[model samples]
Target: MAKQVAKTNAVRLIEQQKIPYELLSYQVEEGQPVDGISASEKIGYSYEYVYKTLVTTVGKSQYYVFVVPVAKELDLKKAAKVVGQKKIEMIAVKELLGVTGYVRGGCSPIGMKKLFPTYIDESAETLDFMIFSAGKVGMSLKLAPHDLVKACKGNFADIVS
Candidate 1:
């Protein structure tokens, strides 16, 4: 039997925007890695097509969202420079839900409690579409990169190494 996953805020927002997407779900057991890279392998998508949503804060109040390929590491200096901040660091895990309205492994660039400035890696611009978490650990979404950027009001930048 297959367990039905409930729709997440991310999914609802995508639908409301009339964006096209494919929902892919995988089994998640206790203590398994649900990070984007593992998700790519688990869901049988190439690592390049799997992107991750990361949240970082500038000072105490300003937050920025970054979407990068799962296999790449965010360049902190470039990230800070692109966002026009002195420095930025990843928000603590405890702050993920409070700030983004999503858990660590389920954070998506869309449908957050508030809209923060968002940046997608330049690499994604070359791809027609990409996959990201659906604001839930066991679910993922595949959608056009341009549609995602338009839906989230994000721009492409060289934020990852």
Candidate 2:
């Protein structure tokens, strides 16, 4: 089931953009996984090049998506300001699942239930490319930052602390 979901998202993105990407698979043990951190090491990619997907709520009326390197933490104040909101808080795992239609470790910027507004940490811009979960744990996709921004309609923000 997990494989099917990831495949669907990958296919959708491919058909949508017709862009080139590499699918990376790694051994991922379930049950309390370390998520993005574990994935970075397992896939032999530097943590700096791997972005973690985070869900957050703003002003009690808006939900936003955040993509940041695991090496940094989400700075809510900075993120809120970037989005023109005064307050922001992390979304619960259940709400995140409902919003993204993907489990905690697998939630991705693409293939979400709704096309929530997205922001990628400014640090990502420094990289030639970045990697993120391909809608499942144990799988990831490698692509250019500009392509990500295009595919996600992502806005750049200094949302990492």
Candidate 3:
């Protein structure tokens, strides 16, 4: 029998909106690092097509979500400019769960506790499909880039270095 995969909030939201996606899963050893790059490799996907969801803050309350390829790094200045903020910084690891209701390796831009303004790197704009965390450490979601943007109410921007 095939193992049944549990649905996460990100998966549920995608389904509720009738967005088509493929769920990918891999083994995650206890205490092993589950970074985006490792996730892409484990899932047999290219780093260019796998994105990492990052949460940043403008002040104490305003939050933003950025989705960029696992192979790239977010350009803080450009990200701030895209969001129209003078300055923005990544939320600390300790604050991630409380702020977005997601742990580090499981953060997905799709279904945060609140729908913050989200931006996807322009690099992904031309891809037929991309992958991101399924709100869990060992699972991922694969879907069209445009579909992801539409589902998250996000815009495409050059927010990577």
Candidate 4:
């Protein structure tokens, strides 16, 4: 059974893997200011290089993880095909927090509630490194895409829409 992890899953993930990682913390405002585009700017990084964690459902399945770029949305059809499913839809924002044990904007791919199938957009590999949430709001982790795949046990493909 999957463990009901604490609030610091991401950090624990790094420790578990014995891999070095740097947590990038930023001040998040009270309200929704900007989406991925502005988040990249706020963090002084490129939009494409920063990845977002999405919880998507295939048919009646609860959810699986999808890591996509901030500049592009998940192409549901492509994502489904890649994951060997007929259809997939993004889960509601509220549901994301529940399943991943992190808020919508702060869902980290590593140390999730369960080891659901994970897909990383192919574009993310083009860069040397990418940034993702640290299992907490306002914290991000910087690491190599290849290392991330090994660390998170994730697969890479062209699943972006």
Candidate 5:
């Protein structure tokens, strides 16, 4: 039998929206670097299905969120264009907890302190489902990209480079 993981803010929000999702858990080996590719392998998901949530800021005061495959980088220019901002920069690691209420490796687009404008890579729009962090390290959620977009009030854009 498998142990049940506690619900996270992301899961709670999904439940509130009455959207379905599958939860996956994996071990985080001590002292080893954990990244999207390793997370996909650990969670038994394809690279294309595994997405990572990134929090970025526009200029000084505005913030935005983006989701992209772990293997790809966010195209800053496209991101700025899609979000209608002059410039966007990844939020510093030190500010993750305070800004988004999540750590770097466990950030989720859902249940953010504020619903910052979010964009998912257009590549995921064609897929049936995508996987992303469940607002916690060592855990992931699998759900339809449409459902996620609705739940997060986000849209799809060509934000990946």
Candidate 6:
């Protein structure tokens, strides 16, 4: 019998929308770092197809989500401009769970505590499909970029460095 994959909020949301996606799960050591690049390698996917989700805040409140390629960095200035914010900084790692209901390496643009404005890197717009964390570490969701954006109500922007 094949091992079963538990449904995460991200996966559940995708299914609820009737969006097609592939769920990928990989082994993770107790202390092994499970970053985006590591996840891509384990999943047999290229860096281009894997993305990382980041959460940024304008001040004490007002959070936003940004999804970018695994190999690129989120250019804060460009990100702020795209979101109509004068300045924004990544939400502290310690605050991630409280703010987005996801811990580091497990954050997904979908199924957050609240639906914040979301943006996907323009680089993803051309890809047939993109993958990101499935609301859990060592798990990812693969789907068409356009479908992802529609599911999350996100826009594409040049927000990477």
Q: Write the per-residue lDDT of candidate 6 for residues 1-161, one digit (tens) a residue.
A: 99888888899999999999999988999987788888899999998899999999988889999999989999999999998989999999999999989989999999999999999999999999999999999999999999999999999999998
CA RMSD of all predictions: 1.3, 2.8, 0.8, 5.3, 1.1, 0.7
**Tens digits of lDDT, candidate 3, 85-152:** 89999999999999888998999999899999999999998999999999998989999999999899
Higher-TM-score candidate among 2 and 5? 5
What lDDT would candidate 5 get against the real structure? 0.92
Which candidate leads in lDDT? 6
102 Cα displacement, candidate 3 (Å): 0.7
**Against the true structure, what is each candidate's TM-score?**
0.95, 0.90, 0.98, 0.89, 0.96, 0.98
**Native-vs-model 2 lDDT?**
0.82
lDDT score, candidate 2, position 27: 77
Q: Mind sharing the TM-score for model 2? A: 0.90
Q: List the residue pairs that clash in candidate 2.
A: none
Better of 3 and 4 by lDDT: 3
> Candidate 1, overall lDDT?
0.92
Off by over 4 Å in 3: none
lDDT of 1 by residue, 125-149 (tens): 9898899999989789999999989
| Model 5: lowest-lDDT 10 consecutive positions | 25-34
For model 3, which pairs clash? none
CA lDDT of each prediction against the hidden true structure = 0.92, 0.82, 0.93, 0.81, 0.92, 0.94
